[model samples]
Target: MSGFIMLKHIKHLNLQYFIKNLPQLSHIMFMEPSYSLQIYHKYSYEYKNGNSNCDDRTHKNLQNYKFKCNSNQKNKEEFNYPSISEETLLALAEYFESFEEHCDSNYDVTYSDGVLTINLPQKQGIYVINKQAPNRQIWLSSPISGPKRYDLVNGIKWVYASDGVSMHELLNKEIPTFISSKKKDIDFTILPFGGKS
Candidate 1:
């Protein structure tokens, strides 16, 4: 209880220096219930149905809470089988191969079997696009967006459910930054637009 009050008081008084200057409180602050900059909603009892508005949480014994609004979950039938995902991933790999051939020597793109790998210029890192055939999803490990699973929507585009941004939209926004800044001629047509490029 005192730990909670002291944490609250410290924030209320904005006593960052005081806390930092005293190393003794450091052990207490990070112990078990760590006080952080973000507010944590720790429910004592099982979470039933409420307003259905929650972002992120964790529960060891209690029932976990879920976001009821804007879930953006689509029907499994909407995304086609292996053909759609395989074709899309392969097409992207070819586009990248063309880009790597035209772009700087540092950039590289590769595709084999059902996986596509792209190594960016400088130390920017690589992008991995692979087909999860069973799930009918295109999983991407991008240098800019980390890891994300994309599902084809309405047979028109590959969409990320968490933020509703399509695979084409994200690549369109980011891929140009690396190309346009260095080269004079960059064909954006190769990048997917309203549909598969």
Candidate 2:
């Protein structure tokens, strides 16, 4: 099989660990997950034999479904997928900060279907791509890992530097309690989003 076909197969297997069955791909292209952030839900219903009130309750119950994942990491060295919690967001932000050539001001953020899509500054060795839903989150592998679906409702959101924001600046500017003791370094080329242009 071709590399594209193999890659799709890998993503298919990865998705099975979260979704009930393999996800239906409308078309087969090598587009990174970041470019696609649409989430579709097909609601289902069932008829119940009872009073109107009982029927209402039964219908509600049938509609109340959730997503859960079975742990299936392809690599033993990789860390478990982080939750989308505030801390996880922070961790991601920190990861971005560690890049040698920090390409700031080249990021974007959008929200759809309760999932937050964050585009980070691209750098060498960091291939990031992501598509997230409230229940299932998918990302293209970087120096980290390739694209895979994960559960994050209860998972902590580890914001890393990769999220493309200066944690020190945010903490100092947004949250006063995190004041740093050392003198802040200034970058003259960094543009007004207060990031390196």
Highest lDDT, which number? 1
lDDT of each: 0.54, 0.30
Error of 2 at 124 (Å): 4.0
Please count the clashing residue pairs in each candidate, in the order shown. 0, 31
Runs of candidate 1 exceeding 4 Å displacement: 1-75, 180-197
Error of 1 at 71 (Å): 17
How far residue 16's Cα lies from its native spot in candidate 1, in Å, is 44
Report the lDDT tens digits of candidate 2 across residue range 114-160: 33344544422333435443323444333333334332211222112
Evaluated at residue 151, the lDDT of candidate 2 is 29
Per-residue lDDT of 8-117 in model 1, one digit per residue for the tens? 44444322233232333332222112232221232222123342232234232122111110122233443455777776777777776766644668888888888898
How does candidate 1 score on lDDT? 0.54
Question: Estimated TM-score per prediction?
Answer: 0.54, 0.24
Report the Cα lDDT for candidate 2: 0.30
Error of 2 at 136 (Å): 3.6
